[model samples]
Target: MQLLYEHRSPPRTGRKVALIITGALMVVALLIFPPEGLVTTWSLWALACALQLAGVGLLALPPVIHLWITRREIIIHPTGPVRRLPIQHIHDMELSGTEEDPVLTLHLRNGEELDLSDWTDNVPEVMALLAQLGVARRDA
Candidate 1:
């Protein structure tokens, strides 16, 4: 079967806003008082701003990172690591009830359950996508 619905976590707007504000403040500070002494430097402050900006940018992107689902297997990339699980290995899929109680538990053939809640958005569309992927509610 063809790969279908895809889902991701919500954009980290609050973190982005905080990063932008901090970067702006750092820029203003650097402009007002440029670093002079070797010990008392503004480089660290600049680096911090850059790192925060990078973090916010990464957070705004999809949390799925990498996903490929086929008739045989499903692969997920979380950070630099990759996990590939065959469809035949999956026994059951469980979807959590509410946003506050969000979770996706995958029961594997090996009797191991993997939770995929942190990688998806808490939305109805996402829930529907899970259902389409054969993830049924535990209560159901």
Candidate 2:
């Protein structure tokens, strides 16, 4: 029996808030520093420019939006390098570490292992998934 499910992670607004704050500060700085003057070099305007680019670049990073898993495989999208393992190839499922920051490990064939705890936002959902997949879910 093989079943797969997908769950969209929660929205993370901290980045948006950070971008807004930084943009506002940059506008204020530009207004005060006057881009026309040679004083830009002396007043660290270059630093502001670098920071703005970095902030915008970070927005391109894809969040942990979807997790697709079945007893045989697990996929994380939209940047998935899907791992395909049959149920028989999954040796064991383990949960370790502190309650607040526990780790979930799936021991696979040929000494391979999978850890999904890092980017996972909702642990309870994953735990339920593991149970459904006959993983013998562990209490964190």
Candidate 3:
């Protein structure tokens, strides 16, 4: 029941931020310095601007905002502040990758795999916890 790892991931990714900023700048540049006959009507330029913003907005999504690991199981924070997953369906772990960067894949009995970011930062702690709990998981 002891807590092992708790991580609060960032809301926005770096690549997504860069893309959004670049899109905004391009829109500003288009309005300030219009291309020759490319956007003759204000309505056409407005439509383009709307589409750009909409695309960026759709791409902006929070992947893994929070993670909690306990001796019993892992608890991923509820997405959008709602819809908490049950622990009754707790699954087993399948470790992969080299020692330098380990990847943990939790497999449910329903044949669905939980997608987890490489929680490498807490690898040592997790290993120590597993050792304390007398859990030996050797990946082949």
lDDT of each: 0.65, 0.65, 0.59
Best-fitting candidate, scored by TM-score: 2
**Per-residue accuracy of model 1 over 58-97 as CA lDDT, tens digit each:** 7667644545455556667635587888766777777666
> Lowest lDDT 10-mer window, candidate 2?
78-87
Off by over 4 Å in 1: 1-72, 97-99, 123-127, 133-140
Question: Clash number for every model?
Answer: 0, 0, 0
Error of 1 at 105 (Å): 1.3
- Cα displacement (angstroms), candidate 1, residue 63, comes to 7.2
Clashing pairs in 3: none
What's each prediction's TM-score? 0.51, 0.59, 0.48
What is the Cα-based lDDT of residue 40 in candidate 1? 60
RMSD list, candidates in order: 5.2, 4.5, 5.9
**Which is superior by lDDT, 1 or 3?**
1
